[model samples]
Each structure stands twice: as C-alpha cells, then as structure tokens.
Target: MEFHLVSLILAFKKDTVGIPLAEISYFWGQMGAGKTSIARLINYCLGGSIELSPALQNEFVSAKLTVRLKKGPLEIERGRDSNTVVVKWGEKEDAIQASIPARDANGELIPGTGIENLSDLLFWMSALVPPRVRKSKTKADSETKRLSMRNLLWYCYLDQDEIDSSFFYLDSRDPFSRLASLDVVRYVTGYHDEHILDLEAQLDSLRGERMAMLASIESLARVLRDVGVESEPEIHARVSRLRETADAIFREISQQRNASVSERTTVHALDGLTAQAQALNVRISGLDDAISEVLHARDRDTRHLHEIETLSIKFRRSQSARAVLAGVQFHSCPRCAQILPERPKDNCIVCGQAEIDDIPDSTEEALLQRDIKQRSEELKEIIRRHDAAIIQLRREREELDIKKRRVERERNEASARFDSAYLSSMLNKERERSALQQQADSLAAMARFPQILDSQRQKVGAIQAQEAKLRGKLKDAREAAEKDATNINTLGQLFLDCLVRSEVPGITSSDTVEIPTNSYLPEIHSPGIADNTVVSFATLSSGGKKTLFKCCFAVAMHRLATKVGAPLPGMLIIDSPMKNISERENREQFEGFYNMIYELKANELSATQFILIDKEYTAPVEELDLSLFSRHMKPNDPSKPLDPETAPLIPYYLGN
Candidate 1:
C-alpha cells in the first residue's frame, strides 16, 4: 500500500511560517504564502486529536507544516473525560459511547455494537486509567478503576524543512541526518543512551511531607497532661469533699428544681426533628452562599463597569468640543451676529459658566476582546464552583429531611405516652454532676488523677519516644526531597541544553514530540532518546532531506492508522513527491523510500492508498503516475511557459 497527499507543519526556530509541502507543488508562487495551513488540516483529519484552537493556529504557529497524505479513520480520545472515545474517518460518520465498557448481570462486559481497536487506542490515549474508583478519592465511590492498554500504535511525520544535523552528500562528506534518505539506507544506524543519574535525585522529595503529620500528634499529647490531669500524691479528703458536695446539690435539686414532666419519646423526637430542621436550613444556607458568591461577584463587576463607563463618558464628552457645546445655544455664525468675543473661554455651553457639575457619556465597543475574554473566564469559573456547592447542598438537604422526619415521628410517639417524673429526676442528676465537677476542680489542686497514674505516665513516655522516631524518619525524608529537587533542576537544565544544541531539529521538531515524563514515578526516558543516536531527516543531503521528509511522513501516517486500531478508510493523497531536488538525487531517494514501504508491506504492517502530484519529470516516475492516476499532465515551468496554449502550466493543486 502507498499514501498520497499528506501535509503537516512543524514549528521552526524562527517565527516564520511557510509551506514546507507547498514548495514542491507550488512552482509559480512567491515565497511564504502560508502553505502550512494544509498541514494543520491534514493533522486534524489524521486524528492527531489537536485542540481546535491550537490546530487552527497551525498556520500562525511558525511551523511550516504540510498535509500531503491522510491515511486512516484514526481513532482518538474525546475531551478531558477519558472514558469516552471518538473516532474520525474522513468527513462523514460519527459515533459516541458512554464508556468503553458496560457490564451484564454476571458482571461481565457485555457485547455491544461499539468501535474496534478504538478501545485500545482510547485506553492508551487516556494513559490506561482506572475505569472505576477504588478509593474514596475517586469521583464515583463504587466505580471500577481498571485500565487496559495494549496493541497501540501511532504515526509520525518528518518536517525536514527544519534540519540541524550535518550529513554527507556524494559531493559533501558531512552528514546531517542520514535517515533523511528516501531510500532506506542506514538513516539512524547507531543509538545513544541518556544516563539516569538525574532520576535518583527526584525520589527524595516525596519522603519529607509524611513527617509533618507525626509531629502534630506529639504536641497534642503534651497539652493533654497540662490541664490538671497529671499524676501526683493523692488527697483522699478532697475526693470525700467532692462526693459530699454532689450529694448536697442533689438534695437541693430534688426539692427546688422541677422540670415539667415530659415523655422521653416526645423529647427525643422534638430534639431529632429540630436537628433535622437545622440541617435543612444549613443546606439552604449553603445553596444561598453559592448563589450569592456568583451574584456578588457579578454585581461587583457590573457596578465597577458602570462607574467606569460613567467616568469615561464624562471625560470623552468634555474632551470633545462639539459634545461640550451641544446643549449651549450657538448662532450659525458667532462673529457675524454678535460680540467680537464669542462665548468666554471655558464657559459651559448650557450656562455662561465654566463649571459643569456632571455630564453623561456613552461607550461603544468598550469591552474589548481582552475584557470579554476575562469576563468569560470569570463567569465560567464561578459556574464551576457553584455546581460543586449546589451538589453538596442538595445532598445535605436530602439527608437532613429524611432524618428529621424520622425523629419527629419518634418524638410524637413519646409525647403521647408520657414518662412523667423521670424527666424531673434527670434534671436532679444533671445538677448533681455539675456540683461534683466544681468540687473536683478544687480537689484537682492535689493533682492525684488515677488516669494519670505512674503506669499511664510510662505509657505516655513510650508514645513520646515513638513520636520522636517518626520525627527522625520525617527529617530523613525531607533531606531526600531536597536532593531529589536538586537532581530535577539539573535534569531540566540538561534537557534545555540538548534542545538548544540540536537547534530544534529544524521546523520538523514539532512533528517530533517530546516523549512525556511521569513526575510521580521514576522518570523513564524514551528508548530512542536514551539511545541518543536518533534518526532525523536533517542528516540527509538537501535532496535526500526532502525525500526523507516524504518517507517519514508516509511512515507516520501508517503508524497513526495502526495506532488508532480502527479499520482505516479512504486512501493516502500525495501531491508530486520527489520534486524538491535534482532528478538524479530525487530518483535515488524515491527508489529508497519505495523499498522501505515495500519491506513494511512484506512484514504485514501495511494497507494504504497513494495519490501523487507528479510534475512529469521522467518516464520512470511519469509512467508510475500514469499507472496510478488517470489525470496526468505534461510538465513545464509555470514561471515561464513554452507554448501559448500552455500559458497556465502549473496546476497548483496540492498546496506545497
């Protein structure tokens, strides 16, 4: 299989946007007519999953990306909610799923009319996460958190328009990127390995935060002993005195304090119902808080805006000479009708006075794009905050209402069957406990609490030792953390230095993604990067680089289709490959690229469609075009034509 018409743009070092693909197909246009825009569309259609805004910005991204061939019905992950999956193949047909899995009564994933291979890509695209929550931290408490990722592939393209490596040509012995050769001649034969000395430094930072929690428990225990609860010599008389005082208070309450006789059930019910009502009120309050937060912010902003508008209008009107005098009576010809001196300078138009107390002003398009953008963000943030609050309020309110009703019923049942004098007796008991507490306070001066006996003191000492050990551990963790931070900083610097040295690998580097790193886990560099002898088109001779770019692009498309795991649709479209270099080099490089594609097919990693924009360079290539495409044209310089009939020689089709 083959591919045709795939274009993509990669960012270049300078802030210049060009059509890396357009130059080949564009024989008659001026330099830099934004040919990379096609690259953006091609990437999008290829299922790169680029954000709409950024994808649209490709033309302005200083990357001369081209879209020469689109190869698959590439499967992609939908929005941030990773469970959902979306697949795009051409401009027709769309599908959506609540999730990739649905279980039957047997707890087995049910067979469904869902996408194929899409699940694998989706899982990988989502980094293969828990499908359901295993902890309270999960959004769904009972949700299954399982991830499966396998059989994933991705496409890669070369934007060789930005090459940095020095390579050897037949005439030039130096190498830029041998991989640039369309003919599969050892592009990247050797490999490099990045040392992991940097990764060890990162592990120390996580150990330090665990130590702080241990220190808090120790301080709490110390405070527990300071409140007259420590062990000491006992004062038995003080205890006797406290007992006597409680007895005396009990007698006094028995005679004087009489709580009205109320059934126990009724009291319980009333208290429970009251609690429920209070909870409901709390829920309502929370809702009100959320609404108020948004409202208050909106109102504050509106008021500020009004004040500004008023002030701006006044300033503008005063500054405008016509505005200041609209209210004043002025003759058509001031000098012709009256005084040599018209109205006195600085005099108000309405009255012959310089001072004007207030003036109204109007504004148009005052809220510029920036202001609108900010307000929109503010509004969205408030809405998001409010949604969480509203959910919490509803949950609390529902629970409160349910509990309140149960308590109310219990109270009513108890009230109808009164428990009589038990209520009075309970009051006497409460007074007795209070009197005992007061006497105990005085006795506490002796500091003879049994809870703080010598045995208990020993136990407390052991706790203190344990706490100290935890502290020591925590200190070690902190040291580790600091060391790790230092390593990370060093790694960051090294990474930047490497990028600078590589010179961003030409505009093509954007197509080359910086493999993602996991901060929470041990850093794992890409095998390609760790083995630094990597392949790039830059090492190719100028002619070879262009051919290598096309080849890499083809390989990338093939990879993306396979990675998506979905059956690909349509065919690859290429507009005149092998047009950027001399005929000899172009033929040699094209031949090499074909050999590689043939090898991939032999390995059963191939299924593709090809469309080429050939300029009728030679019969070997021209005949290939004729065999593939019904529409073939004779080549001529579009800039300068040979015959009058062939005035418009170049059919500017595939936006080079």
Candidate 2:
C-alpha cells in the first residue's frame, strides 16, 4: 500500500494557503513562523486532534488534504472547530462524513469508530489490513488488542517537541501508547498477521477449558470423599453389603405376604370398620369448618357495632355544643371590641336577620342525628343475625360430634374383631423392605465410580495432548517471527549506515546496531560503553544526532517495507528537525541527512514521499536541485502570509 500527498489547502476566513508537496518538500522558517502549523494542518486533515493557534483559528476556516492512493486520489477536509472529517473520492462530489475517537454503542469514545471512521477509511484507501496486537504482554487475547491507523500515525509524524528527544516514539506517558507503538512496529515490519492472531486466540481458549476441567475433576473427587466412597475398592465393598441386607429383607417380606393371604375371611369385616371410621372423620371435619365460619362472622359484626356506637356518641356531643351556642347572645364584637346593636331573641346573630319560624328545614345537626339512628338500626340487625347464626351452628356441631363419637366407638370394636393388629404389623414390614431395596439400588449405582474416574483421567490426558500440539505450533510461529527479524536488522543496519554517512560523533559501523526485536526500537552499543548504557532514541544527547537518527530510521523502515512488499502508507512528514543544531558545529551532519534522503529518491524508495519541516536550509538544501525545494515561507513575508490569498477555497462539503 502507498499513499502520496498531492497537496494541502488551508482555507481561512479571508484567505487560503495552498502547499504543493513533493518527494522532499521543506517548510523552512524561523521560530513561530508557522512552519509547524503546516505539518499540523496536514495531520489534522488526516483525522488528528489539533489545538489551533489563535492566529490560525482566526484565519483558517478549514484544512483540506489531497492524497493519491494506490486506487485513486482522495480529498479530506476538516474544519477548525470540529473533529469531523469529510472525505471525497476522486472526481466525486459526494462527501463522506467521519471523525476520530469514534463513539461506541454506549456513545463512549473508543478507538476504531467504524467503516466510515477516518482511520479505517484511510486504511481502506491504503489497502492495508489492520492487525491485532496484545493490549498488554501479560494478557494476550483476541478481543483485548487492536491496531488502528491512528496508532500507526505515531511513527509517521514527528512533532517539533519530539524531534530531538531520545524517546521519539514516546508520544505520551500512557501505557497504551507504549504498547501501541510496539504493535505498530510489529505490523509495519511484517511480523504479525491474522493467522498468528487466530492461533493465539485458540491457545487462550484451550487453556481456559483445561483449567475448568481440572477444577471439575477436583470437585467431583471431594464429593465422592464426603460420601465415604473415596476409592473404587470401598465403593464395591459397600455395594455388596447393601445388596445382602436388601435380599434378606425381601425374603422376610415374601414370607409375611404368603402368610397374610390365609386371613382373607376377615377382609370384609375390616372394610366395614374402615368405612365407618372414614365417615366419622368426614363429619368431624365439616363440623370444625362450620364452627370456624360462625366465629369469623361474629367477630366482624362486633367490630361494626362498636363503630356505630362511637359515631352515635360523637353526633350527640356535636348536637349538645350547637344547642349551647344557639342560646348565647353576643353584646359586642370580640375581634374589634365594639358595641353591638340589640336584636330580637329569635333572630340569626351571624347574618343580622330575623329567623323565619315557618320555614320547613332540617338543620345540619338533625341530618347527622338521622344518619346515626339508621346506622344503629343496621348494626342491631347485624348483631341479631350473627347471634342467631352462631346458635344454630353450635347446635348442628353438637349433633355431629355426638354421631362421630358413637361411630368411632363402633369402628374400634369392629377393628378388634377383624384382627387389624396382625395386618398393621405386616404393612410396616412391607414398607421397611421397600426402603431397603431403594438403598440397595442407590449403592449399586456407585459401581460405575471407577469408570467415571477413568473418564476424567482420559479427559485430562486429551487436554494435555492438545496443549502439546499447540505448543509445537507456537514454536513454529516463533521461528517464523525470527526469520522476519532480518528485515528489521536490515533497517537497523541502514540506520547505522546513515549515521556514519552523516558523521555523527561516536557512532561507527562496528557499534552493535540493531532494532530490538521486542521494543522494535533502534539500539546501538558502542565499544567501551557501559554494559548498562541506555542507547535509545530518547537517550541521544545531541539534537542533530537525534534528528538524523530518527530520519534515518524512518527512511530505513520505508525502504524495508517496499523491499518486503509490506503495507506502509508511503508518506512521512518530519517537523522542525533543526531545533538543536547550529550551522557552525554540525553543518556536515545536517547536510548529510538531506543528501541521504536525496540519494534514496533514485532507488527503490523513489515512490516514497518525504515532507521535511525545519527552521533553515542546510548545506544539503543549497546543493539539491531547486525543483526539490517545495515551499519556504519567511517569518513575516507580506507577499506570502502563512495564510495566502490566491490558494483554492475549501468547498462547504458535507456541511463541514
């Protein structure tokens, strides 16, 4: 997979800036000259989060990135205030809206939003398949790890802050960043694929099953021990003893059954006694039920009568209070302490009007009294009905009780005459025999205990065998991974070669140089250096050395990918690589960096695109062909403000 940046358009409110990209383009200027902003805008258009400067925010409305993928060209546009990206395929006006840190089903931001997400879309355009990597080395599962284009971008972009650091790839202090860095390296180096990931997932599942089987076997053994059947021999012995005891009981029951048939003449008498006893039991149950019903009714009627009596008392008190108030005459207003005019004795005092004696009306007190009288009569009727019902139910219950007692006496006499004592003894013996038979059957079921144990052992054996087979497969996978180490080593050697060509101090070909297989980081160990020396991108002291090392390493990886036909996006944008270098001290090393890049253009890396952003032109830049120099903006060039006026405008596509 290969992707080349064709151009970038930064559209401002009043103006726009268009930057045409080449194989080796440089945005060289002084500090705060907006050199880094160009690189940031490119990244922003590619679905990166951006914190725009006040100037850029006020000037730029949106940024657009145009790239030529293997399939065709694509244009991605993004506004300054939003993370949404609008992508347009070649010659297609229909824009696709997408964003980064996509929301999941629960509407929470998670990596790899969906098919329309910028990361996945870019991957699709690049023809690169996303690979799986362990989220953590300690927990390796299919569902736990993921490698998206967003994570891969960490390697492709180097901001000014990180260009001189020894740990160039350490974008943040997050644990996931470190893991993702390793995974991205593994993926781009052609060391991981779907088949490897599938094998890992299967191994994880198999291990889980094996553990469960072991736990089950342990639990079964414990249960067997609690039942006094710890071993096969003990189980067999118990079974034999139970069988003998059951057989002896059965023989006794058979003899008793045979002897009981001789007493068939008494069965008729026994049946008559049983019928009499059953009739008495039924009569007693019905009498008890009737008594209960009558008692419940009496209780309910008593509560209702009490309520009626209370209501009657309350009404009588209310009438008494009203009569007393009606007799009193007011001489003055109590509230205002004012004298009142005299009135007739039968007049209504509240309304200051004469009472009409002929008016036919019942007062509120009279209505309440009538209601109380009605409720009292109703209560009295309920009491009378309850008392009568109780009396009748008691009479009926007494008669049934008398009949039941007489029938019971007769039933007992008949049972004695029929010799029920002998029949009862036989029935008890039969029940005991049935219980013993059941116990024997239960013991006999344990005869297969040895087979069960054997089955468990076979299961464990099978799991172990499967584990061994998977181990062999894993070993083969490791071997294949080792074989792929050559590609990384080749890149590492190229890195060392570039450093030597750039004349970096204390760096030589004899130095042990290689990209650590685990970290996928370039490590160099010079002679006489301490055994514990930290030799990594972060530990490089000289700024020029660090920048040169990072550039060389990136170029080496690009070359290796092309050589091995690996899926790389085929574009690298380095920002401000001249931060720590002075022309007087490191002119040769600075020139060597660009010279190496220029040399690779004539070789297999010719198709690769490199965007270099720095503060000034080095020796190599002066010697390089003028056509290779893309865009150079001065600090305050009136003719070429960071936001140019003649650049093409970003269309209002997808409402962005």
Using TM-score, give the best candidate's number.
Answer: 2
In Å, residue 308's CA in model 1 sits off its true spot by 49
For model 1, the stretches where C-alpha displacement exceeds 4 angstroms are 1-42, 49-543, 546-580, 584-586, 595-656
TM-score of each: 0.27, 0.55
The C-alpha local distance difference test score for the whole of candidate 2 amounts to 0.68
Kindly give the number of clashing pairs for every candidate.
65, 3
Best by lDDT: 2
Q: Which regions of candidate 2 are displaced past 4 Å?
A: 90-116, 140-144, 170-173, 197-475, 528-535, 618-627, 637-656
Cα RMSD (Å) per model? 20.3, 25.7
Q: In candidate 1, what are the lDDT values of residues 231-345, reduced to their tens digit?
A: 3434455566777777776765565445443423223333543565577667767756766675566566556656655665675565586566566666544545653335676
TM-score for candidate 2: 0.55
Error of 2 at 495 (Å): 1.2
